[model samples]
Each structure stands twice: as C-alpha cells, then as structure tokens.
Target: MRLFFHTISARKKLVFLLALLVLPGGCSRHKSPRYLYGSNCGICHHGGEGMAGSVPPLSGRIDRIAATPEGRVYLASVLMNGVSGPIRAAGVPYRAEMPLFRYLSDEEAATILSWLSQQGETKPAPTITREDIAAARAHRISAGDVADMRAKLDLKHPLP
Candidate 1:
C-alpha cells in the first residue's frame, strides 16, 4: 500500500481520492419522486402511512383514491395547500400538521403524486399530471378547508 501510494503522482492521488468520494454519492443518488418523497415527506409519513397513518396509508388507499376525479383533485389540493388539524385514517385518528409543498414545480408535484399513487401494490394506478397540479394550485384553498375535506373524501372505499 505504501509503495503504491509513493509511486503515484500527487495529482493522481488527489484524483483517486476524489473518485472514491464522488462515486458513492453518485451511486446513492435517488431519482424522481423517490427523492422528492423521501427528502420532503418520509419523516412523519413513514412510507405514506399516517398509521392513523403522510396523509393516510399509501399501502392500498392511494390507488383507490386516485381512481376518482374528485379524489385526485383533493390530493393535489392537499399537496399544494397542505392540511392541518385532526383527521382519521384506517379507522384511527391522527392530528398531523402537514405543510404546503407549493414550492415544487407543477411537473415535480405531478411526479410526486404519481409515485405516491403507485406505492405498495401491483395494481395499475392512475397518473397525476402537471395539469392536475396546476388546476389545484389555481383554487388555492386553506389548510382548514382541506381538513374539512378529509371527511367528504371517503377515503376508506374506492369511489365509482
């Protein structure tokens, strides 16, 4: 090891050390909504379950919810405006304070929601689009409004 180090020029040694550092970061980088979700949402959502679960469990409910036009818009509203106060999920109640992620671009919001809807099952899920996010943004409801929306959403069953 000492002999190999001595044989290399200073520039080569620096290059080798830099490559060692950069490779792991490059390889570890997460793509698309995984990064968006993990970085922005993974903390409390814990893989998207409020446990009473992010905003409710992504385990099975997301695909069901996204199947409906109203549900899709509600979801986009939650993401853009966020919801506070108490809510029930999976039969239990949770009072998490979700913050608005309005800073995300329309494309990024669509990507995140699309990823969320696809989580935890093999069933094909509907895709959220930039247009969906944009429309939600246009409405600009408050957190209280979304909190009230939780009840009407009827998230427990898939809507026709």
Candidate 2:
C-alpha cells in the first residue's frame, strides 16, 4: 500500500509540474504592446470613431500603400509617429489630428505594419520589411512630416 501511494503521489507531482511549465502565469501572457493596440486602439481604429476622427479605414489602405516603396515607407513612418492635419483617403478628404503612438517597440511597429499591409487590402500580399521600417525611421519624420509629404503629393488638404 505504501509503495502504491508513493507512486501515485509522484505521478501527481509530475503532472502538476508539467502543467505549470505549459501554462503561463496569469495576465502576463497577453500583456504585450500589440495587445494594447488590439484591445484599446482597435476599439476606435477598427470601425468606430477613434479620437473624434473616423479612424482611417485600414481595409484597402494596406494594399494601396504597400504596392510601392514610397507608400510602404510612408506608412511605417506614420505608425511610429502619428499624422495630423488634412489627409485624404480613396480621394475623400479628412481633417483630423491623429495622436502619435510612440510607445510601440521596433518589433511591434514591424508587426503592426506587416499586419496592416496584409489586412485583406492588397492583392499580392504586402511585403513590408524591417529595412523599410529603418528607412522610414531614418526619414527623421514626425507628425510634422505629414506637412512636407502632403505638399509633395500636392495634397493641399489631406485627410486624417
């Protein structure tokens, strides 16, 4: 009887250890910065009015922006920082100021950008790279960069 009890106890302990190893601690597993965006940013950026401005629809913007190098670079910069003032989408003008989100890490930025690029928007699939991210970062860009980019694009009144 003693031998059988010990064996069962050992088996129970082993199972408990395995469970601990596989199951991460509470809440920490989902605490990533990406989670912040999905839960919080998505609250508004998804389909609702985000920050008083209709969040730029991410559906088709991804493909339209990823097809060209300039577009990809432009998007990465916008994500790292934010854009404000007048901007346009699908030819419609939007006038709003997008708050900058600088808390995201480089990897997080890359992931968000890649996901945005592929969000059922583009046809061939977006091909955003870390290199493109670096280039966009190098643009020394900021919310203010929108002014210059818009001027170059001849967007006298771009949308948000």
Candidate 3:
C-alpha cells in the first residue's frame, strides 16, 4: 500500500510538471521578448519571415520603421489597435488583418517591438519604450485607422 501511494504521488508530480511546461504564460509572469514573440506573433509571422505574400514580415522593416517618430507612432498604434487591408513590405504587397494585441501591457509591446527591430541584417534599430506605447494608447483608434496611417508613412526600405 505504501509503495502504491508513493507511485501515485510521483505520477501527480510528473503531471504537474508537464502542465507548467505546456500551459500558456508558462511558469513565469515576466516572459522574454523572444518567448512572447513566439507565443503571440510567431504563429502567423513565422519567426518574422511572415507567410508568403499574405502576412508582411517584420525583418528589415521594423528597424527602419521604428527609427522615426511618426513611424514609432504607427508601430505602437498597430499593436494597440491592429491593422487590416493592403500594405507593402520589402516592395511586396500584402493584404491581411493583423489582430490586435491590446491586452499586452505597454512594457510588453515595447519589448516586442524592440526585439523585432533587431531582426535581419540592418543598421542599429531604435529601442521602443513603454512611453511610446502609452502615447499611442492615449488616443484609442480602430484597426482600419491604423491601416490608413500606414498609407501615409514614407517607409521606402528595400527588403533583401
């Protein structure tokens, strides 16, 4: 009886361990930007490479886009509100609806953007801060508005 009880206890422990590994948010509250990206953006963006001509990739583009003040606003707004409709990245056209991540905190959004900026071979990318995200959140806008905002930006970088 004692041995059987011990075995059951061990099995329970194993199950608990597995749950921590497989569950969302994992075992910690503060997740790394890479981990955050994997759980959130990686599903569609696929390591920032994107999905063919549908979803636009972040590599080579985020760094340049985040460099300017207006571009930074666009990035923040996109995260808060999401964006849909047609857009171009690396000269390729993309038409898709990027879901909103409004639930993410300002710090989390900023960190994710900063991580994206470092992707691909490009000049040093600017560090997006929580303040930038907060500023964008100050004025809540719809996803369609964000799409319109993207239309006005002068993002002319050619992706390789």
For lDDT, the strongest prediction is 3
lDDT of 3 at 36: 84
Better of 1 and 2 by TM-score: 1
Which residue pairs of candidate 3 clash? none
Mind giving the per-residue lDDT tens digits that candidate 2 earns over 1-160? 5575566777787886787776764333345544645754576576322343455566556656666666676677676667877766655656746665556555566666666656654567777776776666666666867645755544432323
lDDT tens digits, residue span 1-160, model 1 = 8899999999999999999888765542235578878777776677776444435565566666788788888889989999888876666567857889998878878888888888836367788899999999999999889977866776554332
lDDT for each candidate structure = 0.76, 0.61, 0.81
**Clash number for candidate 1:** 1
lDDT of 1: 0.76
Q: Tell me each candidate's RMSD, in Å, in order.
A: 4.9, 6.2, 4.7
Highest TM-score among the candidates is held by which one?
Answer: 3
In candidate 2, what residue range of length 10 has the lowest lDDT sum? 151-160
lDDT of 1 at 1: 80
Per-residue CA lDDT of model 3 for 18-114, tens digit only, reads 8877776653346888988888889999888898878888877887788778888889999888998888777788886998898888988998998
Please list the residue runs of candidate 1 whose C-alpha ends up more than 4 Å from where it truly belongs after superposition: 1-30, 51-56, 155-160
**What TM-score should be assigned to candidate 3?**
0.77
